[model samples]
Target: MGTSLNIDLTAPGARQLPKRTHVQYAALCFRIREGKVKVLLITSRGRQRWTLPKGWPMAGLSPARAAAREAWEEAGVRGEVLETCVGGFTYTKRTSPHPHMALVYQLEVVSQEKKFPERGERKQRWVSPKRAAELVEHPQLARLLREFHPHLRKH
Candidate 1:
């Protein structure tokens, strides 16, 4: 004897999705001056949108390390990246159907070079957190920038 069972997926009930989501790591690089925190923002290559330094995970590199590398590559930033994730945000890419979740790590910037890998391709800026919040396109990222507070000794 054999038995078979079937269920309607679109019967107006909760259903589980089998979709795959991509993950990227990002660096929220910042420097403190006069007790105010300023964050670095870079222009995206395609749309030229203001955004943080972020990229896909690299082979043989940890998430935080990959984010630090992205910071260096995108904005000429050499900094200390906190291993703990500050927060995450999701966005859909133009070429892919899967949404990408970006995990953000706080990086205390040490130095920014006059020339970097993406210098000719993008514009960079350092602005107060509130200003940065206003500049970025993503709402969640803007909120993260708005609520950011790093507890570190003043330099």
Candidate 2:
């Protein structure tokens, strides 16, 4: 009998493969008043970087629905999710346990509570649209803020 070497083809680096990814939904909630457009941003609990309210999607609900829920939970604001998506951008999840692609949405802030339960954990701010663009760390999100500037101005 001849000795033979058996290779495991499914090994991690056995083949060049596409990176695995999951989809995460996020909400960019804006409050426009007196010709001034302000965007709600949250300081992440983990990274402490200023970013829009977002999280993983939920079962039995649409992406927009998940965005709405995240907005409420993170910012203590309730909003109406527009039928149209203002924009979307992809971001690599370097810190998340699993790799993810975030689908961002625009939500109109209809109402808000005086206090948020997670206020201690997260810092929320309503900043000018232009300032928001500068504040958020994500370039893609900043672009979206600029894209929505016209609509935000009118409202």
Best by lDDT: 1
Per-residue lDDT value at 43 in model 2: 94
* Cα deviation of 107, candidate 1, in Å: 0.4
lDDT of 1 by residue, 29-70 (tens): 999889788999999888999999999999999888999999
TM-score of each model, paired residue for residue: 0.84, 0.77
True lDDT of residue 22, candidate 1: 85
CA lDDT of every candidate: 0.84, 0.73
TM-score of model 1 vs. true structure: 0.84
**lDDT by residue (tens digit), candidate 2, 61-154:** 7888998888888888887775445565556565755555567767778898867666678888888867888988778777776656433323
Give the 10-residue window scoring lowest on summed lDDT in candidate 2.
1-10
Residue pairs in steric clash, candidate 2?
none
Error of 2 at 62 (Å): 0.8
